[model samples]
Target chain A: MSETIMLLCAIAGTYLWRALGVAFSARIEPDGALFRWVSCVSYAMLAALISRMTVLPLGSLAETPMSFRLGAMAVAIAVFLLARRGMFSGVIAGVGTFIALVAFA
Target chain B: MGQPNHPPGGRMTARAVVRLGLRRGVGLPSVIVMTSMMGFGSLAADGGISFLTALSASALVWGLPGQVAMAELWAAGANLLTVVLAASLANARFMPMAMSLFPLMRGGTRHRGAPYLLVQLLSVNTWAACQEIFPAIPLHLRVVYYTAFASTILVAGQIGTGLGFFAVAFLPKPVTLGLIFLNPCYFALLFAGTRVRPYVAALLLGAFFGPIIYALAPEWSLLLTGFVAGSAAFFFFDVRPTSVSNAESK
Candidate 1:
């Protein structure tokens, strides 16, 4: 029962912003002040979420050592930088590093 | 504005455009969507989230950060309000994304043809790739091209989530564990890929604040960090107009 409501709420919240965008499309500038601020907020939110998941995960991920996790992040960033900014390249590199560290060390 | 790769008179057929949209969507865009959804599926399984709940999120919510936040917060026993707020905050970037892409897509007339539903297909990658190529497309075909592209990505995304949900049974523990890292790694990569100064500033500040605030108050961390860091980045952009214009000109 509660799960259903939460799902609806989540969907509504996400669509609200998008619908608002459509409504105000003509007036809004992508790089304008409000957009920029909103962009910043969303980026910040995502960054915070990513860091939280890595540093303070709740499940199987928490079983892995911090060193392995941190090492994976470093390798991933390096690959991302070197591989023409590809997301899959970075993620694959990170996951591979994590698995390798766990297996070898 | 960037010049179109093809001339205006060159009519892009719906079939040809759909083929083109699918082909371009095949590589990084689909991979990112598939892998991220896969990670979400695995995470959902680990958290003991129901198949229906997780799949609904993939099909409906679509935004990974929001889906992940909802799952994590729910697992942490957060109330409905917290879950919604966190999820919404994570997905709020869609506004700017839609704003930028709408004007670029032919008329961009608001509420035209049930845009609310159409925007559901507007994954970040679809928007990015479309911006680069849509200008080359004839105005009449722009909507067809975007719809085809977005829907194709959506299909791949849904399939990926379903696979992830079931893969848990056959997949190795190490593989399952590794999948969870894919979403964050990709998200971080996406952040790094953005050269825009405000995004960079917000990212750095957000990274700095995430852990600090988590230690202080886990529940409020996302909201507080986002508001403070994002506002700070906005100010950073505002204060550095000269450099911004220089970068813009270049």
Candidate 2:
């Protein structure tokens, strides 16, 4: 089917970069300026993803008010910082806050 | 270079190697990976993908986000080429990641073939953990140690997917939501907590720009936001080399 072909194509296209990265591993140094730039870009892109999911959410979370979402994120940030900015603590705080806010509202 | 970077003999027992891997990765991070994969596998199953197919995808593709996008797009009836294109874009992030970790693990007599085999196991979770632990591991054992760790996570992920696939009937709404949420939550916290300051800056700027871009153009927002926000951080780092060197020094 066309769908199957598409899936295979997607998988191959994605793998191309992974394969390329491996092939050129020696040539690309992470500490160099170019790597640093890409790292920055990668980081920003990741950040955008997280923010989009929480702030501009889609599907189910969209029904949950934006203010509530911001509050959950704020509380999570607070917890993350309070726990010396540990990731586990931040995730717990954010999810916990969202669940509690939903329950109370 | 004298003893080679990985295990000198390349003959360590599989059990010892696996133990080293587990010891290296046993923590909240690995737990996060397992849980996220479980949720991902379950969602795929719920959407009507076969259990074998889901596991095979994980085994073959290995990048969960790419796999998820591929399956979701497929289910939504996107053209095959488009699905593949989108999946490749989603996975473009991994190129740098693999580039970062490979050198640290390559041995003096580095079997080029080994890394290719290991590439199948290369995901963000494993890469991050390897970066943190690679320096501390004895040079000679680094390969076996990392290979063990990578394989364990791979097996654990497969098992998690199997569970997700089979447990579709009984999963509750709260849990399903939790599973979907696992993907983003782990990503945000992990990025936010990294010592990579430029990346952190990227996240901050990208977060701000993502919605703005999305509002302007819904379909292309992800690509546009990534390029725009990433370019911003890239230019900033280019101009401010001192900031990066200072952070590295500390």
Candidate 3:
């Protein structure tokens, strides 16, 4: 099935990076230019992914109003900073706010 | 608390280390991973993905970002290559993570093939834990502790995935949507929590560029945004020697 193939490709794609890391572990400098650049690239990619998901999502998430999604994110970030970077509380607050908004509004 | 029983020396036995690792796995780390995977499960379900497939993604992909990307792209009916590329890009952090952690893990190991299996279990949670815990563990036992710990969390993630997948049937639509939203929320918070300037710059620039580029080219937005924003951040915040040292000091 295509699902299985896609899963395999996903696995392979993910493993490719990990395998490269292991293979080049001895040679690669963790704080060197190459590593730092790669780290930045990954961070940027993740940021892009998250933003796209939040701003222009697919599937069920698109059903919600963009304002609601942005509001939830704002609440989550605010709580996260207020809690001194308590990720658990931040996530719960965000999800809770979204649920309340969706249920009530 | 009473001390754990050990051999004549203070060093723990292999079995004891394994037990400790398993116990650690069931602690706060597993809880966090479980909760996040639960969110992933709900998202997958909302996307009309089957439970088995979702569970397989958690088990095989193991990285949350990559798994989420795969699910989202697949649900949107993207081609296989695009899905693979997007997922891989999202999960590329694992490269630097593994590159850093593998050296510490390789200190007392002799078997080259062992890392291949052990690396498969390395997720963000495990890698972070190992970075903090490996120095205290005996080099010889590092691999064992890591394997046990990582495997336990992997199982926990699978359980969470299953729970989230089925909970959709009983949960209200709003609650399910909230659960699905947890993934992005968590990532955004995690990124915001970092103090690294280049990383922070990259996050902001990427976010700013993400929607704009996405409106123009949905398929290439992620890659293009990453290159443009990441390279900009890298050059602006990281290229200078003084700034590199300044960033590294923190």
Clash pairs (backbone) in predicted model 3? none
In candidate 3, the second chain superimposes onto the true chain B with a TM-score of: 0.72
Q: Write the per-residue lDDT of candidate 3 for residues B125-161, one digit (tens) a residue.
A: 6775675566567767778889989999999999889
How far out, in Å, is residue B229 in model 1? Answer: 2.8
Stretches of candidate 1 above 4 Å error? A24-26, A30-42, A86-88, B1-4, B7-17, B73-86, B99-103, B109-113, B127-145, B217-220, B238-250
Candidate lDDT (C-alpha), each: 0.76, 0.68, 0.80
Candidate 1, B4-68: lDDT as tens digits: 46685485566777677777777677777886688788778766788998889988898887888
Is candidate 2 or 3 superior in TM-score?
2
Write one digit per residue (lDDT tens) for candidate 2, span B58-135: 776777767777767666667767677766866766666666667666662367676666776777777766666666
lDDT of 2: 0.68
Q: Say which prediction, candidate 1 or candidate 3, comes out ahead on TM-score.
A: 1
Interface RMSD for all numbered candidates: 4.4, 4.3, 4.1
DockQ in order: 0.54, 0.48, 0.56
lDDT of 1 by residue, A6-91 (tens): 99999999888788766766565544566556667767766877787777765567888888887899899999889887666788
* Candidates 2 and 3 compared by lDDT, better number: 3
